[model samples]
Target: MLEPQPTRSEAAARPELTREMLEMVFDHVENGIYLVDGQGVTLAVNRTYEEMSGFTNVQLVGRRLDEMVGPDNLFSGSASLLVLQRKGPVTATYSTSTGRKLLVKGRPIFGDWGEIRYVINTIWDLTVVQYSQKIDADTARSQMLSEEDIITCSEKMMSVVDLALRVAQTDSTLLLSGESGVGKSLLAKLVHRSSERRAKPLMQINCGAIPESLIESELFGYEPGAFTGADRRGKPGLFEMAQGGTVFLDEISELPLHLQSKLLGVIQDRSFMKIGGREPMTVDVRIIAATNRELMDLVRQGRFREDLFYRLNVVPIKLPPLRERRDDIPLLVRYFADKFNRRHRCYKQLSDELVQRLQSLPWQGNIRELENLVERLIVTTAEEIITPADAQLEPQEPELDPDATLGEMMARQERTIILSAWKKHRTTRRIAAALGISQASAARKLKRALESDIGAENQS
Candidate 1:
């Protein structure tokens, strides 16, 4: 026999059930959800948020995010506030006072009149994971072109990636300006993969790497007998070869001034003439240019064409250097270590001391330098655990007093180690983990070390 079902009248009588269901769903969601009004006042926070942040709705529901974020408050920063300021979506990563690092993506909801009504912030924990688990080398290499390979936890780099992904759908020319080894080429590949012309080819040419004499022929293929060494049969240039695709012009600022005008013509008319050819050949291709030097500076110096600069600068994306995004160093270290370990068919893990030491370096060569260092360490280190001593980095030691007692010398050494760790890993929990101590002990020792340093500085 079929069980009796509730009638419309019976269901309507218990309207509270609908509200209860919504509340249950909100609380049970996996990711933390934070809702804020346009005025920046916290509207609601789900149970997930409370669990993740260790703050209840009663404390956050009526509070302003700005008031809650500070050195002495619940958060160090708020992405929802950034969205309200920019009137757009924002993705940011920040550490909480609770020692939890979080990645928050805040999206604004616009009202009928185009004003922002609310901002919804979705949060994800970015805490570093243990490196004991091994990754498959083949699987890691296979994701090189995919989004997963671009490992970054820094907010600045996140914003850059966000902008790149957003602009990938359009056909506008892009100018990627950044220091070398900042992953400009990788980003260009990402843009191509994410574009409408993903099925089409992505032709790459380094303007600086090629000899100036043959650059014209390489970019715009010569007609038969156009030049002494020209092929008998005319060939298609990059613009033609990359038909319905993208042409990544690496180190574009190095292109000779004479070629800039021709490049501009291709940008303006979507056509270019082959060497020794009278008629222009039409082509459909997107242009993505990268440069390490400042194009504007070169323009003022008359080295680069202003018109061409403006053409390629339609959508400029400047990637921050690795040094500027230091928060990503540990993550990058782990990634490269895993990558090389898989490649070499050996399992190796980086010691906390070495990782902390790496974080303190200037990294003038940026990500390229870090990757090379990690690979070198992985292959060269004899043991399964790679340490700072294995890397042969200069030891950071405190100056000793000739007449000081053994206990005093030991105290000085301890202070030096604790201070150095504090410089690289700011949080007490991280410092404690790096130094193999309890969080409470780390905090107490750090405070005493700081006070002693201050006293010494005063005396000096």
Candidate 2:
């Protein structure tokens, strides 16, 4: 049985919809339409909603919406009310009485005084848009570009993956900053793969890898005689080549400040001309920038532009260092070993002691370093099982900059401790009680921790 719900009269008086309009709305709607008061009480239900629930308006008018969408099944914090507060549209998910899932998009209806009148929401049953999920599945494939992916048991790495996937849908400028070898490029590739632009080619450029003189020309093309050794026929630049696709700017921190303004201009105006071309051309290139450097600090020190930083930092996804995701060492090792084994025509295995040694050692170089170690173990270690002794590669954890803030360091330490605990116990309840938190809260925090941990690696 469901809990008894309060009605609209519990707070304010209810308003009426004209009969003709109400009939038109109820009759023409395919998705179930409903209105709810700020207090969560149901006010009106369209014909579609009535048919789905097998209940008349008289039976449901005064019931709480939560009766149908339990707190657990909801996306939480009513988006309708949020829209009402923000005076904007909001989207959310809800479960229906018929056990079908719904994607509810809503806007807050306001009175003349700008007060929240009621939340008018339409729920398009997920089944109707089921076919569109294939686009989402394809987006997922784009991100798996570096199939040498690791076990993201840590919270940070998981957060990065989820954020990358979620933000990939939107055409937002993204900045991915983390420690080196933390799979920054891999995550960037994933974002490209997960976006609607997956059909478009994903072009990658490393600002640090390219010569300083050629970086600008490479990004913004050159005319036939623009350069001393320009192409015979003017070639399209990366921005042009990546039209309708994504251009991942790796090592973005290395981009010269002189070029930052041009990059920002291109991103903002979505148009640029070749080095000597007079007319500007437009291209739709989603940018995912990655850098292991602290860009904010760089900006403060006058090395990076604040405007460029803001443009790219719309979503800052950080990848966790290997030391933080140590629990995944064996998993990654096995994945890489198997990959190298098939490639090298060798059957190499790791020993239990080697795994323990791996866990004990702090992997400063992160997943990339671990991968190299695995390959080395497979290639050179002659024993049937590769022991830690055969894996001579070791990384000394880098020291953090002295100017790193106390708050930042403490937050990082807290994350490390929490992630290590969750990994060790493998249960949120146990970790929560041990850390003196409510079980429910523990679960949420653990989820976020796992999200953030799996995405970013610590620099030190």
- Best candidate, TM-score: 1
RMSD of 2: 18.3
Please give me the total number of clashing residue pairs in predicted model 2: 28
Question: What's the lDDT for candidate 2?
Answer: 0.70
Residue-by-residue lDDT tens digits, candidate 1, 205-304: 8888778886787788778888776667765666666778788899998899999999999999999899999988999999999998889989998999
Stretches off by above 4 angstroms in model 2 are 1-151, 392-460
State the lDDT at 300 in candidate 1: 94
Q: Evaluate residue 20 in candidate 2 and report its C-alpha lDDT on the 0 to 100 scale.
A: 89
Query: Candidate 1: which stretches are off by over 4 Å?
Result: 1-148, 395-460
Candidate 2 weakest ten by summed lDDT? 129-138
Worst 10 residues of 1 by lDDT: 138-147
